[model samples]
Target: MDPYTSFQVPTGDRPKYTGKKLVMLSPDASMKNIDAEASGAALRLAPSSAYKSHEEDYIKAFEEGDGIVFEKFRIAVINANHEEQIKSLLYARRSFQYEEPERYLYALDGPRSSNFGVLLWQMLCRLFGIKKDPPEIDPDPAPKDPLPESPPVFENTGEAYWGLHALDTLANSFTGKGVKLAVLDTGMYLAHPDFASRQMVTKSFIRGESVDDINGHGTHCAGIAVGGTRGESGIRYGTASEANLYVGKVLSNAGVGSDSGILAGMEWAVEEGCRVISMSLGASVEEDSNYSNIYNELAGMAMDMGTLIIGAAGNDSRRSQGRISAVNHPANCPNILAVGALDRRSEIADFSCGGLNPNGGLVDIAGPGVEVFSSWKTPQEYAILSGTSMATPFVAGVAAQLLEAFPEATAREVWDKLVDQARPLPLPVRDVGAGLVQSPK
Candidate 1:
């Protein structure tokens, strides 16, 4: 079957291929068999255990060889142009399990084009002095015992981001100390003053690019997950203030990346024993499209290795127009925790995707995503943005806190605790899942 036939996107929105292919081999597949099937294509096999010690060599091999095999994941990213050979390997050889064209994924942030339309309409209304009624604010119920503090509404104060207050992070005693949290995105600004005193490890998977976050999306997401207080405002915006940060530049400075780079980052994070892996990037999928088996399998493997992967549900929905899109790829994978976005009112964000499809395409939880303020690239220092991308790292930081609070718990157990401790909201389960995620008190 043609791999592309199973999924469809809008005419111009169809993802572009990277002129490469991802081939998943069986666990017992032999290197000799892969070479024989490759028809003389140059290939390199990289053992997962050697990634940490020989990180640079592994990356170099991937770039120089026709393809590189990840021994741990039993997967290979190869530069293959012979369609017949690939088909023969898939159909004739039992060693080859699956194959798909490598496609690019984008950082999931920034305002959608439709948002500009709304902004223009509001401006015209102001110019004409046309008075409009205030938007209705939903009433959220108070949390049960142990969470005695009422949920704080959105406030642009200089003390802390409203997201931290809504999750009651200030009241939590756990600081995520000793936990390893990985943020896989467009890299981070290593010299940022706010993170100068924190312990961090950094790497870049995008060829020719360093782990310097020029795109700012990764920096903002990292700020929400593990950043400290700002020097000037003294405001605490991050959640896991002391978690050991692992910054992996999977996406490039252009805010785009292919599956090979992303999967390589995932392998590194899992090998490093990171307790939580946060990915604020994804490719859009249609309502009837199924989740990628490759990502689902990798997610399950990571979970078994004691790492819980969290991803954005995508900013493809337009609630005002009554168009709700399905959860994005990877996040739609069952093992990867899918996080939806919530607005300042504790209501679902207008652009947050919904569980419009069955079989693993669902929103597992939500976080404060609208008008979220966090760290940015140099000069700007800080900025406010909105998207489900912001919500993902918020949950990842909370996961780190949970790992610190329950040091003996497994990754799966921590996932269950997040769902159980979430404060129930008066909203549809499709949008909010178990409701707003909360930190352990």
Candidate 2:
């Protein structure tokens, strides 16, 4: 059995870990120290091979398999420099570090920590470039900067039953009661100009860090979902401009994270009482397998409890991805609203994953996900990204609006309304579930 199962840990429970760790210092003899990257680097020289080569006699003596017990095990490469940075990271001092983590941190913790994660919090940061010191970018900028005026009143989009027009119609019917929609992704850019008038609740799942967006994906979704639903951006006036936002940082800077991290965010979302949880993220696990059922069960539970979970259909447009339908995970859970991508030109995105399950269970909706621009970290900037990542939010933000219209509605009711309004695709039923979700009159 998997250790996770053996631990009897419910998949719905967020991974609660004690924010504690032991510290160690490199001996005086180590490699030559180098200039700073993120945290301070302490250089030192070290002797080679602290332990002699293991012999068969010693191996046999310790064959019991439970001999030496480490108080803690974390990866770090032993080098003359970057020792202090590694120390600060383990103890949770620095927000990030830029270095060959595998060379130092991996050496200390072992290979386990150096995989996908190093590519995010460590590697991507290096690729994008890192600062030698903390960003003092206007520390404590005046909070009194007069909030910008709310944008113009949204005109009705007539009644588009599905796709973009329906989404636009939903925008016109919003109640502006400030319903909460939590998005689990990289993080949000709370300070963007399009969001100056909006309120946000932010949290982090990455252990020590605060909710700082690194990949820019999460923030972009935030802007499109319920951003400043008005202004020169046109009716780009976010789908639910009146809704509140909760950003849950699960993916790292490299756009990568573990299943445990995503699960942790889900648990937190339910606890926060968010009316809607939009997850424009997903994975393609092995098909026709129970390997992914644990996640599906969790999503189903969330749906049953009245929370709507929206997920991306992934970017791989294909019929079958290695015995599995192209539907993305959490999205495949039958309970979720799996959204696929459509380019602005109104065509299925070549890379938009599709083709339904042989079991008949996914791709419940489609939306315009390409060339869509939204919030960035700076008030004056934004990023135009495309993918089902953008499509899922289109439905979620509208669901928040639906909540305003049907406050007494359950998750199923919300789905019913969208289904009642969506435009049916000509493709096979399995290829595009119940058509595209849309706004109802």
Candidate 3:
């Protein structure tokens, strides 16, 4: 019996969570029942509509338990911000403890994560709430982990770098020259030879600001975009090899970060004049937040000023994709292109998200996402891995190529050209927007 309240919301503007209690109906209750319960309490309805989907935005707020599935879109209202207030007004209301947000936190976008951290707790329990313990992630369960020297040229096979051909072709044409790319994952190793000539712009969004590739994912993506292979260590063929590089440390050495840190990274990338931004991360959101719109519009503005944004569909191969299942955020925005995965065979990657978006649109495009090889930060190793993560750079590299071919083209034009030149798929045309992006069209 969580007390629910509502407020009027403008139609086009996305929701900016205002530190109010947000509780779902009892597990067994239906939307109809929830509506009835609200009516019985005589709580006035507040308009709670956001133009953007909040699925990916809310992933950080609630980690699922074995028996819970609070992922559906539902009518929600804001009530008082205290347990006493909730109890006094609503009969038999189940209470979400109100507490304050963590003091150590720094957010990239405050509007998106306002309902989480302390704001969520304070709106319910009215005190600095004690956080529930996080589930422990075990150490070393992967089939492989780099130990005592990683590969110098590849991850799965030395052949992973073949994707390098795509980036080089774009550079050969000069589209990527001087463009700034911000890698917002794990930190980058300052000594990677390929970036020696690059203008390095770095920042730490997390605590203990170390801009090092602790988990190696950032290094891999960076290598594909622009890295010095063994023989050409002096002159690498990167997607935008001559482009400036900015490394934003959002994800930690473990490749994990909070929603705010990631959002902050986006803002920083835009502020740095990066022409292209790529993300290999994913999460869930139940409500749209101001943070989403701010970033979307920022990217839109970037597109207007010549920036291209690309996001990985995610590596969650499970058929159901965590719940509110669809592609990841930022990429799902109409203005941004969402990339799904595919393998060397050119088939839809098993982990790829396919279908019309629940929010009314098709997921964007597909690319060569599987088993791609690229440089890693570990002194000697490179890797061959799969994920739309691997696919996104291909698109970015192609965008760089578009810049070279059509130096005067807008970001939208470059994206349009990439789609126009895409190879048609035998399946899921709606799920895979244009076509698989090829190199240097």
Candidate 4:
């Protein structure tokens, strides 16, 4: 059972591309020299011989397409009309006939029936036996015995912070030295004293801005992931103290970003040989809807290239008020690790999101997010914040440590290691997944 089968789009209305749709084109695998420019050229210059009518409009749409071409995916940022979308989808399907994603279109407005003609096209292909049925969803397992809450053990370790001490970072001496980690979020402030010894690679995907911390979210996340040196107060935070940091300002100073900027940042990180990518941003989505097929494909390619991506599950849910929400976009995708939040008492944070979807959406692990203390922007060099955003980089920093420990391990292997070593908590799997994410021993 394909999990996506559960998502039912109302056919009463045709899909509309109200704004720009991020279109991902499949790469021509046969062409060893198939580059983004070449692929874009193919989509732009090649005659739409498949169209029996309205060829001029289709050519015009391709000519007007403006976007980046990656090694495995070509993102065509276009204000698509119905005809243009249908023709583009058809071209992609015809070009890559086997194992292609069912859909390639993503609307910034939302997932509308009219935007996903490929779903209907997929059914047509099934009727002609061009594709096999997607893999069935595994039935939910019987409830396992609740894991016993592990008692907290406190000791002086470095800054003696409970979060880092719990993971035994000082004892293990796994500071993620020499590993390359990327944090994709608002931005980073390089003038901070903690990062003075580190050489960072930075980029700003948000238009008309430099990679500098302004909204403080990305700087905070970067501090948690890789900020080194003791603060003026002598608190030692950040797990990967020595890891090479790559900061991409995906979100703008107003703390907002689009899917294109985020996607472009991911591509740039992977191209820079980043093994661990941390994202602390997302949009609210329902349980029934899975992440975009484009994100799933991009994550798949990233994993194949030895990069592990982690995202915040979301912070929309308030379990204390009996409100529980599904994981957020991109994080809901299977290949990306969805991190939930935990309080100092080792309990689920009230504001942390959960794994609510019976099928594809679920939290992968837990991290210290509630009232978590870490570096912030200047003037106020420290702050305590709570959200799945705070939790995600903790996991990413630990992932960097794992990469340093197991230098040759693939992304999947590192993921398995984290799950296998997690500290089991007395909580439901839906609330806490495989328990709190642990550090490399």
- Highest-lDDT candidate: 1
Clashing pairs in 4: 1-136, 1-137, 14-114, 15-114, 15-115
**What TM-score does model 3 achieve against the real structure?**
0.59
Better of 1 and 4 by lDDT: 1
TM-score list, all predictions: 0.86, 0.60, 0.59, 0.77
Residue 401, candidate 3: Cα error in Å is: 2.2
Model 4: how far residue 173 lies from native, Å: 0.6
lDDT per residue (tens digit) for residues 95-156 in model 3: 21222111111111112122243234334543545434222121113233222231112122
RMSD versus native structure for model 1:
5.6
Looking at model 4, residue 15 earns an lDDT score of 27
lDDT of 2 by residue, 147-167 (tens): 223311112333321234535
Model 1, stretches more than 4 Å misplaced? 1-14, 30-59, 116-152, 156-158
The 0-to-1 C-alpha lDDT of every candidate, in the order given, reads 0.81, 0.53, 0.52, 0.68
Ranking of candidates on TM-score, top first: 1, 4, 2, 3
Clashing pairs in 1: none
Give the candidate number with the greatest TM-score: 1
TM-score of 1: 0.86
